[model samples]
Target: MLPPIYTWLKASNAVKAIIGNTPRAYRPGDAPQDVTQPYVTWALVAGVPDNQLSSTPPSDRYTVQVDCWHTTDKGVEDLAKAVRNAIEPNAHLTAIPVNNRDPETKLYRIALQFDVLQTR
Candidate 1:
């Protein structure tokens, strides 16, 4: 997992205000058995973060796959939408939301990819 993504999520008032520091699983293959509902789990889907070549590489660019899980589809979609809104800290940075389901666990999942460019 990219540390910047983690840091952004951790420090995001938008996210915290919505979820209130709920459990965030870094690159988790499976949600923890004891973890509460409407939580977050993420995984590294591709390459490491690349440098944003803005004259002096002042920022890094990367994609983080964020998954929102909940018992109900409504809950999953709502949480996912909140995640999408929360992660958008900048105009150039955005998250694409997709509806999905975990193949193994068969839980409702709101999959999102946050395309980010953060200052170094």
Candidate 2:
């Protein structure tokens, strides 16, 4: 299932506001030992709606999903932390889950979900 369009838009806007204005850099000489390469790139994927079911009635809740891609594990973790820090500070943001994908290759992708409460 997917979240509603409005939820997606809100989440996308939040992510863009957090990441798009942040300053970042890549120093070739400051590369970590675990990372063989001297470069890293990070980007936040557009928010998507994730459908979720409720245990009680026929009601459902929507989740906003965002993905972050990095060239190294450290970079991915850093970005994930940044995302959590960015969203958790908002009073409207209820819950957030950050997941690390398996198959550790040259590229790492972190999936972030920010759940919004349906009721007050």
Candidate 3:
């Protein structure tokens, strides 16, 4: 099943303003190398099916890591805020956001973890 994160971000005008409309968000390794700055990438880091007494689980919970990247620190911070504003209404923030600059690429990145529950 597709995660709702992509759908939410793509639908948000704030996020589209920074990342563009065509490619709003990408899977961990799916973004093209030549992708422009102020882009977003996400991955499902973990999942757990709900347990029940007698029937199959009717829902699942997922932990996803979403990362915003840009050449400028302020740009990445703005992108990350947009992403959070889009997803935070439905998903719960699971970890404190972490940011760092890649020494080799000099790209600034901010990573956020969220927990999303989806019905099966």
Q: Rate the local accuracy (lDDT) of all candidates.
A: 0.64, 0.44, 0.87
Winner of 1 and 2 under lDDT: 1
In model 3, the worst 10-residue window by lDDT is 21-30
Tell me the TM-score of each prediction against the true structure: 0.66, 0.40, 0.93
Q: In model 1, which regions exceed 4 Å deviation?
A: 1-3, 10-22, 29-31, 46-56, 91-98
Of 1 and 3, the candidate ahead on lDDT is 3
Best by TM-score: 3
Taking the tens digit of each residue's C-alpha lDDT, what string does model 1 give over 1-120? 353555656666656554567436455756567766657777655544454556655556666688777777877777776666666664233455667777776678877876656566
Report model 3's TM-score to 2 decimal places. 0.93
C-alpha RMSD of candidate 3: 1.2
Model 3 CA deviation exceeding 4 Å by range: none
Residue 71 of model 1 has an lDDT of: 76
Candidate number of the best lDDT:
3
Q: How accurate is candidate 1 locally (lDDT)?
A: 0.64
* Model 2 residue 31 lDDT score: 38
Worst 10 residues of 2 by lDDT: 37-46
**Prediction RMSDs, each to the true structure:** 4.0, 10.8, 1.2
